[model samples]
Target: MKKLVVMGGGIGGVASAYELKQAVGSDHEIILVSDNPWFEFTPSNPWVAVNWRKPDAIRVDLDEAMSRRGIRFIHDPVVRVRPADDQLDLSSGTVLDYDMLVIATGPRLAFDEIEGLGPEGFTSSVCKTDHAAATAQVVEKLCEAPGPVVIGAAQGASCYGPAYEYAFILETELRRRKVRDRVPMTFVTPEPYIGHFGLDGVGDTKGLMESELRERHIKWLTNHRIDRVESGVMHVTGVKPDGSDAESSTLEFAHSMILPAFTGIDAVMGIDGLSNPRGFIPVDEFQRNPTYANVYAVGVCVAIPPVGKTPLPVGVPKTGFMIESMVTAAVGNIALALAGEEPRHRATWNALCLADFGDRGVAFLAVPQIPPRNTNWSSSGKWVHLAKVAIEKYYLHKVRKGTTEPFYEKFGMKLMGAGKLRGQA
Candidate 1:
């Protein structure tokens, strides 16, 4: 029997491994490697930062959990991936060979790209459990002493949902603490406008998000490039529509959480033919790296081109629903490979997102993620917030059970005629 190694333990990686186990069954041995022993529910990170959800409650121990499913778990950081020899080097000084590899080590926070950014710098983050916990501390101090707040994404950054979520969630928390009036919040983003969400305004998202921000009494600046962040201040360069310099400004903040750019992990970077210059692995429609047929990728580590040209750099988003579709396609292809047949599965890469606004939220569905979708819809209400909580709990339950596709969820998706891959027949 051959062996399959899946890297990273986030939603994309864990879900892929679980689905692979269910698909291949006893045909192959599966191993999962990650830098952390726990799997984080990244969607709930915004809630965690505001103490709405506790860290331990959202974290699942990969060692105990994967072991229950008969999958080996390695909690060491990857030193390097020598795709040339089908070998993986780990920080623990061990090498492993795999018949197939799925690189899902999500985006490495490119904090160093900008001086004095990220957790160790001027602003805060919700990228990881520890980061959320640290930001929670910042939130508490901010509650005691309210002041101006700045939150948004940096140029070249792809994930914008979390930044928007942090802004609204933090606003909700401060109001709960009876300090909303004193704290002035401003959103800073590289997108030409609000609600671009890296996919070029899906289904009136631009209008909806802009209205939401206005209703919340939050100010916004678009086409903004973060030059640098220095203690309680951020230097940003505003770019015009024609990609020319609009102006430069320095914004002051009592508390801030600026999302930084993302890059591929060091282990997967600088590998010719395997990844793009930005360190993201380039995969075909089937999610397989062209150079290494046995290698596949999903989630933030996968390379996708920008939607269109913009004054500031803006990349596409790999939402959870889209990543699940990729994971499903990968599972089908791997199953085909185990049978010595050619792989034939391609991911649809659609976008179904839920943006919770503390007590209320917004939800959108873009069948193809890009604009002009056959299915493009958006709605908002308190029920969306409830749905977000429900999804968080459901996802955690499935993770603990090592189940990727429950029959009920799949049936529901089918009834709605959604969540199927592009080439599904």
Candidate 2:
């Protein structure tokens, strides 16, 4: 019997295991290893940061959930990934050998790339559940003594949705606390313009998000390169579209949350031809590592080039739906290989995002996520906020049950003219 080992228990990892177990039948052994014992619903992290959600409400026991589906689970962190020998070393001294491997370890928060940033530094973060909970505590403290606030993403930060979401969520929370007036809020980002979202301003997202920020009484600074963060102050260098110096200033703030650049996790970083300089796994269109055919990657762990060049670095986003498409393609190809067929699955790699801002939000769609695409559209409404919440709940439930491609989400996406990656050539 073939042994299929999936590393990382994030959305892509869990979903990949589910699809593998179902497709491979009971003949193959499958196991998922994750550093954390519980799976956190990442999409709700912004809400968690503002006390709108308790961490426990959006998390589930990874071991129990996977065991129910006849898949093994390990909570030990990966020590090293020896792709040459198909060996996986764990922190607990367990060495796992796999016939096939799926890598979904997710992004390594590159907090150290920026000095005095992240939770360990002077700012807060909504990247992880614990970080979000900590930010919530800080929010309460801010309520008692409101002051200047700053929220934004650093250079080369790919996942820009959460930054936007956190900004608006904080705004909502501050307003609800009746301390909005006291807290002068600012949104600073490395994008050339507001709402670039790492996709070169998808379908009027610039106008929609700019208007939202304006209507919410929030100020913004784009093409802003953060030099560093001192206590209660962020040094920023504003750049023009041509990469020339435009302005420089120091902004003081009582509270701040800046998303940092992301890189590959340590286990698989610098693996010869497997990864790029930033530690992100470089995979072919089928999500298969070009150097190692047995290895596959999905989600933030995979490398994606920037949408376009800007004065300040801006990486493209791999939205949830796009990640799902990746998971589908990777597993489907693995199934084909097990059936004595060549790997042949292509992911649509489309992006659908809902950036909730408490009471209302903005939504966008990018078919074939990369630029020069066929479809690009964006809009806003209160319904977006409601949809975001529902999606969070739905995804958490699906994780708990170990059911990938929930019928409702799958059918709903299809009904809305959304498509997942499937076998093509």
List the candidates' TM-scores in order.
0.96, 0.96
Pairs of residues clashing in candidate 1: none
Roughly what TM-score does model 2 have, to 2 decimal places? Answer: 0.96
- In the predicted model 2, the residue pairs found to clash are none
Q: Pick the candidate with the highest lDDT.
A: 1
- List lDDT for all candidates, in order: 0.88, 0.88
- Model 2, 1-425: lDDT tens digits are 99899999888898999999888858899999999998888889888898889999999998899989999999999979998999999999999999999999999999898889899999999999999999999999999989999999998899889999999989998999899999999999998889889988778899999999999899999999888898999999999878988889998999999999999999988789878889999999889999999999999999988877889889988777888888889999999988889888987787888899999998877776887767677778897898887788788888888777633336336536543222210
Count of clashing residue pairs in every prediction: 0, 0
* Residue 91 miss distance in model 2 (angstroms): 0.7
What does the lDDT read for residue 404 in candidate 1? 69
Q: Model 2 segments beyond 4 Å from truth?
A: 406-425
lDDT of 1 by residue, 166-282 (tens): 899999988889999999999999999899989888777898999999999999999999999999999999998998888999999999998888999998889999989989999
